[model samples]
Target: MAQSNKYQTGDQVKVRVDSPSHHYRTPTYIQGKTGVVVAICGRYRNPESLGHGGDGMPEQLLYRVSFAQNSVWDRYRGPSGDKILVDIYEHWLDPVGV
Candidate 1:
């Protein structure tokens, strides 16, 4: 049987700063940013492994996180409520304290 999702919708989480010296899917700009899990995109084969021609296995949970533009950028000059949604994996997330 498949495992249940570790996070739920509306869960506050922080993206971990895992700067592996290899092909990665998470964008550098979103690293260390805090956001809310808006949706769970299910699981899929690990892409980082497939990037280097390895057989992608052990699928991971993907989540749609929404982050306020201002919260993500220190010098953000856009709309106050503008947000960016990103698809992130389970391993890249850290639960934020209430």
Candidate 2:
């Protein structure tokens, strides 16, 4: 069965600001940051579960999220238009307005 995506391209989202004691793939720097969904990267087995010797089941939806350099860093010296793309799981994101 195919999983339905919760977000679409251009949708505004914010990375969940969580610190789990277990293994996770979401970067610490991107946590709590707001970004726009750029693309749906499809589903994959959850790595956090796999890291603990458990079967990675119920694949998670992944998306390409874009964040402006200026917004991600306080002293970013790059162009204001510069942006970074991060592959994030759906569990690590929340809809901006919801």
Candidate 3:
């Protein structure tokens, strides 16, 4: 099925910080962290739903987001050029405030 994406490449976005009672895939490390949308991986079933044996319908848009090491870790001791990439679903992302 075709779905519209709320973000595109180069768009700056932030991962949501939520503690849901159900199963979810977004890692704790990236929660509340900001990143850039590197690529759109198209829409797919929500993993949290699939993990629980649900229909996993109403697919969600997945995005390949890249973040600076320092952005993910405040005390990152690596090179300033370091980066970390993670695939995050649209539901877990939101626009960063100006």
Count of steric clashes across candidates, in order: 0, 0, 0
TM-score of each: 0.92, 0.96, 0.92
The C-alpha lDDT values of all candidates are: 0.92, 0.93, 0.91
Per-residue lDDT, model 2, residue 10, is 97
Top candidate, metric TM-score = 2
Question: What is the Cα-based TM-score of model 3?
Answer: 0.92
Would you list the clashing residue pairs of candidate 2?
Answer: none
Clashing pairs in 3: none
Candidate 1 Cα outliers beyond 4 Å, as residue runs: none
Give the C-alpha lDDT of model 1. Answer: 0.92
| Distance from true location, Cα of 55 in model 2, Å | 1.0
Score residue 1 of candidate 2 by CA lDDT. Answer: 81
lDDT: the better of candidates 1 and 3:
1
lDDT ranking, best first: 2, 1, 3
Winner on TM-score between 2 and 3 is 2
lDDT of 2: 0.93
Report the Cα lDDT for residue 15, model 1: 96
